[model samples]
Target: MPDIVSFNKGHYYLLGLGVCVGVFGLIATLEHWFSIILSEATVKKLFRVAVLGLMLGLLLPHFSHFGFSRYFQSHGYISCDAASHRWLHSVILVYTKNEMLCKELIEARK
Candidate 1:
């Protein structure tokens, strides 16, 4: 049987907030430099670039999560067990639940 996953509103909210802030921060920093280079660009060009950036920003969290999981698994910070990958899944869940806990756990292993 497959494991059933549960959703926590707080976790999702935190993740969403984190993504939004991170994306906006990146956009702001990039815009400062891009503005200098594209000072003569049209509004339409800026709009297109913003759209593309938003799309990529939405995927950044997932990509970062995948990278963290891979690193943890390879470093033995998480276990491979029961042919289930249960430990790693649980760790990821805890991560979404409380990011501080995840950071502490990872750093504690050092």
Candidate 2:
């Protein structure tokens, strides 16, 4: 097993991604059930609730110390940690320019 002490930002990001994916899957399952068991209007409302919950779940990590640092780094809110900041910039910068760069960055990080 990999040492917990050896885990880095990339590992945490992967874990966060896994959690987001799991929440997405769960929301989708609930949506499916709502469609089958609820009236159309109720299904729509519940589906919206599910989607909102999923979005909040995905954003939860961004409120953490590690995630907040990375997010601020990506946005240029802080500059004390250049190395880590650059890594996060690589992840978020592509959103303003080329989406492919994010994929390349993640691949390179791996």
Candidate 3:
């Protein structure tokens, strides 16, 4: 059987907060190393070029399909009951719950 999953509102918030912290750390590290390695002008030019290229890549055919999931969800991909509560019970919340579960499991061994 498929693994059963449930979510609480606070859990989803924690997951997004975790991901935001991770990405913020990543960007901070990139900026720090970049300043150490290059002049201000070079870093500015490179960052502009690179981030622009990445943005354009998101518009390509292969990458375009990523938006379909959102579209389908909005268009009622499943029954109303499931669709209505999908946002409340997202993968983000499930991941956060799993993390808490793992921590509890580890502490229980003591």
- lDDT tens digits by residue: candidate 1, 73-109: 5544432222222232232232222444445545654
Write one digit per residue (lDDT tens) for candidate 3, span 1-110: 11223233334334444454555455567768665455578657655655554444433323333343444445433212221233432322222123444455345545
Candidate 2 contains a number of clashing pairs equal to: 0
Q: What is the C-alpha lDDT of each candidate?
A: 0.44, 0.45, 0.41
Where model 2 places Cα greater than 4 Å from the true spot, the runs are 1-36, 66-110
Q: Pick the candidate with the highest TM-score.
A: 1
TM-score of candidate 1 on Cα atoms, chains taken together: 0.36
As a TM-score, model 3 comes out at 0.26
Error of 2 at 38 (Å): 1.4
Q: What stretches of model 1 exceed 4 Å from their correct place?
A: 1-41, 79-110
Error of 1 at 108 (Å): 14
Q: Write the per-residue lDDT of candidate 2 for residues 10-100, one digit (tens) a residue.
A: 3344554555566556556766866545467875665566666555545544554465456544653432221223355133322212334
Name the candidate, 1 or 2, with the larger lDDT value: 2
The estimated TM-scores of all candidates read 0.36, 0.29, 0.26
Clashing pairs in 3: none
Candidate 3 weakest ten by summed lDDT: 89-98
List candidate 3 segments past 4 Å from native. 1-7, 33-110
Worst 10 residues of 2 by lDDT: 1-10
